[model samples]
Target: MEPSTGKKKTERNWGDKFLNIVEKTGNKLPHPATLFCIFAVAVLLLSAGLAALDVSAEHPDPDIDEKVKVVNLLSKEGIRDILTKAVDNFTGFAPLGVVLVAMLGVGVAERSGLISAFLKKIVMGAPDMLITAVVVFAGIMSSMASDAGYVVLVPLGAVIFLSKGRHPIAGLAAAFAGVSGGFSSNLIITMIDPMLGGFTQESAQMMDSAYTVTPAANLFFMMASTVLITVVGVLVTEKVVEPRLGSYTGSYKQDLDSLKPKENKSLKIALFALIAYVIVVALMTVPETAILRTDEGALLADHESPFIGAMIPLIALSFFIPGLAYGISVGDVKKDKTVVKYMEDTMSTMGGYIVLAFVAAQFVAYFEWSNIGFILAINGAEFLQAINLTGIPLILAFILVSGFINIFVGSASAKWAIMAPVFVPMLMNMGYSPEVAQLAYRIGDSTTNIISPLMPYFAIIVAFAQKYDKNIGIGTLISTMLPYSIAFMIAWMIMLSAWLLLGLPIGPEAPIYY
Candidate 1:
């Protein structure tokens, strides 16, 4: 029999062929925002179906005749309330406010050419084998600054890799793994600390009337997790990603001309100024009587501690001071007008981000107002509890559930807002601590972030890959990263399970139970 014209099979490797199929399909796929709207409709339909069938559950309602009420999406008041809340929620979200404020300083750093110069110096000096490791390390560190890893380090990884005659895509993957995959784990506390802590507190309160989940609840565990992820990320980049890429020999070349060195005198002055700023900041954060600390000596745990609550502003200044010095030295900021321009320019880049955030905020608010998330969470928790699974099996199941949810909804805090209320209380009822539940959620959230299209930066990654291979698409990127995602998932779960069995503290004064 002759082969059909519609389906002529070639002798290509299955992996390569699979990638080809994905690229073709992705090319034909609708735009991401359109896809999101489609999914939102589907969610609406599903909610509608549940309402019609009266399959939804509700918690105690003091004023109502029935404790459990059917979710009515058709109700005009309900829909109006949801839309109103969504709009209000997006505009009022605190993180957006924080980012905007911090960017004023960061903009100055980036514009002064300080950030680029510093990165170039580091890249030039780093060893060959250590290049991938350093990119990953920096990605982990950049988490302290929030979203800078996505905007700065991930693209820089591609640039660095291309410069070194390695596959740029592989470099991007390694950095993405560190930035998004290791999002929850970091050496230093970040804005995420307080965000997650807020969610944890909400979850814990379901069981305890006066419960509190500290911002540093998982600090120790996160510190260790940072080391674990870095080791794994570096190994995977070298062993798996590099070997698969097989000596790039591609036509792409680095634009070293873009990286002009600063004048000697300016460089020297900036270096001194940077040193002075760092010493001052360190002194404020270090001693028992440091100004950044509370009277009791705690840095962030106390409300009165400057270092604790003012970390974001401090971060902004860290970048701004060095950037200002560098800019002044390099004559990039010859006038006060130039300095203000740098700050303004930095804020401009955030325009697209703000739009995305607005949409995401609405979606999150709508989800919360509908009460559908809470209902689903409670039911899901009950089902999991009924399975009677324990230890590794239970933890693994939670990881899988988290990974699955990540594909549809990318926000960690939003997902936790829904999941924590149910899982934390259920687990606590089953003798697991709120810390353990939160840790499990973190593991799941982190491991799958790299591969999920729902992730806000997934599109950015696809764009990065296309710069290397025009034929590349979402599938190509996902396939390349599947190995790292799988490896990290298994390894992270095992690490968490072992930690749980040992009864060790996840962080300082952070216990695994009520």
Candidate 2:
């Protein structure tokens, strides 16, 4: 019998159609490298405009007898100096040096099969309901290892789902949502804590020359955020992602041997090594006599303290030392040469990131030279203050504004460097603490990460998705992840509101108000 028209099978071919559009549009749009160059040019032009108008907060009071001249970017010397200094700073940036150093240990973990083994054990062993939670939890934990979540676990999420007979794209969405969307929320202090803390301190100094912000100021809030984000992430994945995917009958397959029980010897060795490493690190920070502590018997309490400044290096070593030991015991890394090779390999993957960083650094340097960010911030803050808005409304506004800016400029630290100088002090003057302001900025910054194409790693994720289904593209990926993004944003904002109402500290000594 012929099926009725309504019941007849229709070949929608949505995936193919979507890919065609993506390919077409991508061809028309500027190259990613060119896009960055355009951003540099835009910033340069803006700086020139601001300079020509003498629009800056640094100008001397008109009532003062001394006349001050604005530095114009249009001048040959000014343009040359801006470009020269930006290039120099990009080459010599401290964070780039730190990331490169840390990648050495991270590379070994990846190449030695240690990271893969660990992820497989966790994903395969966890119950179905627990998979989402586990992925989110893992995402939170990955911040300790820098960009490992984006680079490693995001693709692994899809592989795990494929092994479980589920839609691999859904798994990718879940992991990407958790890793990038929940980036600011983590159980442990990471390289980002210190980096953002430095910006906060610099901004605070502008208001009160004696003021200093501690790295741990928002630790309490970040710890709470970990739980909040994980729960929200899991719920979104289960309710939104899984349902949308329906019953997966995808052709992707996984090797059952990978899931089979191994000797468990490597697991035990890795476990013991991890425990010992933790104990040693704890000892270093626990006692007043520990060398990592400051004169005041605090770890990472002071801005100039070595412990706070060197935390990234310490974190790198922690991962490397344990991972190295595990590799040697398991015969994955035979000698020191293998370890060095792993380090070099990890660095090789950073070529694109380095280029992005160079362009971003140029934009940042030029913006600073023009003083436009500061001028805008100061004027904006003063306007906000004049309106006498409540603390919550003010912060909420800042979050929205920051989120808008995030779509175009994806670097969190760079965004904060520009926003913090104005927002932090302004909020402080309005009786809010720098920690509160920083937390708000973080929430806004993180929520938009998954949605922004400007984010350096977003394309990497799209490629990861294509590995599972050749037809998948940006639209499909975005649609899959949008639920988590919306859910996370609403839930996180609610959590922040509740925290504010409860007068809970965002971190140790982090307060809602001054």
Model 1 per-residue lDDT at 199: 75
Q: Supply every candidate's count of residue pairs whose N, Cα or C atoms clash at under 3 angstroms.
A: 2, 2
Residue 10's lDDT in candidate 2: 21
lDDT of 2 by residue, 169-284 (tens): 66787788878755688877765777788888877777788877777777887888888888888887776666655565545565434533442567567778888988888888
Give the alpha-carbon lDDT of every model: 0.70, 0.69
TM-score of each: 0.76, 0.72
Position 82, candidate 1: lDDT: 64
Clashes of 1: 2
Number of the top-ranking candidate, with TM-score as the measure: 1
- For model 2, give the 10-residue run with minimal summed lDDT: 2-11
